[model samples]
Target chain A: MIKSNSTNSNIQQIKVAVDCIIFGFNDNKLELLLIKKKENPEKGKWSLIGGFVGFDEDLDEAANRILSDLSGLQDIYMEQIKTFGKVDRCSFDRIISSTYSAMILKSRYTEDKISKYNAQWFPITEVPDLIFDHNDMVDIAIKRMRRRVRNFPIAFNLLPPKFTLPQLQVLYEGILDEELDKRNFRRKVAQMKYLVRLDEKDMSESRRGAFLYRFDETLFENEQNFNL
Target chain B: MIKSNSTNSNIQQIKVAVDCIIFGFNDNKLELLLIKKKENPEKGKWSLIGGFVGFDEDLDEAANRILSDLSGLQDIYMEQIKTFGKVDRCSFDRIISSTYSAMILKSRYTEDKISKYNAQWFPITEVPDLIFDHNDMVDIAIKRMRRRVRNFPIAFNLLPPKFTLPQLQVLYEGILDEELDKRNFRRKVAQMKYLVRLDEKDMSESRRGAFLYRFDETLFENEQNFNL
Candidate 1:
């Protein structure tokens, strides 16, 4: 089973890396976490947090490890979005990067961990130019996230456990990058049987406080689509 | 700008390969193209048609190259469905494979080329236990293809340029592995303004032939969703 063919032996091996596009939602806006590169080639430049995969690690393992190292958190909701393998994508070396898009509760991360990695959260619309093909990666990740949010109840990952309907609407607008009609939006929300109304209300947005609701995971299990 | 970090230098490199899960439709059944391995650790076992990616080649390029070498056809409809890197998925060596799911018109491929590679088309449900983790790859590819067909008009890739409504419905049923109500299916097809009916009739199925239709690409370009 360890035998090698001529084709295998002659093929050159290339370094594989995993880059994480960590997304967070705050202040009615979608945000992205980017780190300032501390090494040469792209030193001081903003880039998606990434590193070479360990010899024994699987692609998903590598993605989770890299995200955990910078976030000081584990079990983050993440998925591999795509793999970018252009020969010169990385100017420093021929590294094939498998990129992942992660949704994390922004309030959970410790500030100390963020400072240690020189990480900063930029509002999705105002992100600075990133090094290498990291900008392209972010754009693609956002598009994937937008498409995913329409079909899955993944926005809960970016929201607090208890939130108002308006808050949920704002989050969807941020991800979709378009304002939705209020009546139409609420009509769609009413169809979702998985949103449990809580007794508590949030008073910060208006004098007439809006009731808070929690996403019921157990109920969602029986549901088919998150068409909102 | 070309400086490498110690982490990059210390990391191990692995061979990258591309495996194509080529799908086709024939006789109202979905089929998969698989080749019998000629050499070994698992010689004579059925496997996905694949090869080590050239050092200078992009991943998509490698997929197309591997597929064309076997089928002797270029410009096939292919997409990178997922990348499999379970560390030991391949027993022969430490290799990472980026898998692609491709849809090709079954009638277009020459029989000589298929025989040359010991390739055979098997009904998707009857696919044999393939070499390595190819079965898992095929399963993932099918799931991706199913999801894709829901929101995209990719089924056209598996059908001839000119086809009848019955033929199209049969292809859909084969891909979805489900029976559809003839009236309901036709109702949905009626909404697709892009399906242009021609004066030609296909009399192969019955004395009163079905009207032939062509998918109008230009009209589809302006339309948003392929809800069918």
Candidate 2:
């Protein structure tokens, strides 16, 4: 047991790391970006992109750096999920990690960056066994994301800037993992009033096509209490 | 910057501590349990009841132990709010602290135990200046508790085993920091249907008396999604 007394020289300083659970959406399915561990203790196993928190860096900075290094995306919508501090969570040392979850558009990542780290996008439902407690981190991240999407307008980070109503509904359905009646979903969207209809149309799905909509950042920022 | 390489001997281990923000409610106001620091390096200053996280102990266990030691309350409704890892947050060393928040009824703590540690309860609105980033910890704790009470049935933990609807409403008001319409609040409570009405009345507040209600844990457990 480490002593609370600050002057105790016998007290040990534990290593702290940050894990990023980056989520993306495409084809009506939720996806996670995972990489193969290239270091000792768990080399060649699937794992979350994580590294030790530098003594000079804040936890948030470490998360942003790791996310950018892995996905080549900057200013991503990231949240501090929680800290994982089990006594033996890491195999190599007594390391405590802070887990962060990020929602990014799947289209934002370029092929070159994805290949640079040998990172692959896998359907969240069929994620491969992860190294150490990475799997538990994913499970916790997913739960937090589900709850977050239900309460806030933050999930729009998972979609493109301009999207059709159907596309938006599909993203929500994928996240909630439940089917929504189209009429009821549209009604709820109409009531939100923070999504403005664009004059553009997405003709990819059908001949009639679907009208496009974009988030009203001004309104969202003004109305802090807006919820779906 | 600290190197991520595990073999780097120059990497320094940082000190970590756990601070507990224990909240209790009575007299329609939110109160916080704060103690005068008893150790050196800012001893006798107002501070959160905190201690070092033992190498062999889990973070949650450390939080529980600290809370019990300070308040003489065990198994309280405590949760990990977040980790504050700012480099200069501590004065003695490079210390990162994980802050936890706990809710308990004010009536539960005996006066003798509180005086044992020179602890005093202050309304959260007018908390005295605390050492280190403890004030920031309180602000974050309040925000998380507000969101938590709105989503979970855990708010009942702040009240006695038998409470009146008005008492429940007061608890919500204290947490949300807002006034709710009486008719609308009762209607929402009626819809929840998880509060079992008891055949008792509390005449302390009024001669007509308000009926007492007890939470039905069975019903709440059976219902998966209950929201406000």
Which number leads on lDDT?
1
User: Per-residue lDDT tens digits of candidate 2, residues A1-228?
Assistant: 232343544345577888889888776778998988877778899988788887777778888888778656678767788888887776556778888887777766676778777688899989999987999999988987877676567777666789898888888889877887888788768755678899999999999999998988788755443220
Query: What's the TM-score of each model vs. the native?
Result: 0.83, 0.85
Per-residue lDDT tens digits for candidate 2, residues B38-58, read 778888899998888877677
Q: What DockQ, on C-alphas, does every prediction get? A: 0.33, 0.32
Candidate 2 CAPRI category? acceptable
**Which pairs clash (backbone N, Cα, C closer than 3 Å) in model 1?**
none
For candidate 1, give the lDDT of residue B78: 77
Q: Report residue A81 deviation for candidate 2 (angstroms).
A: 0.9
Correct interface contacts retained, every candidate: 0.41, 0.32
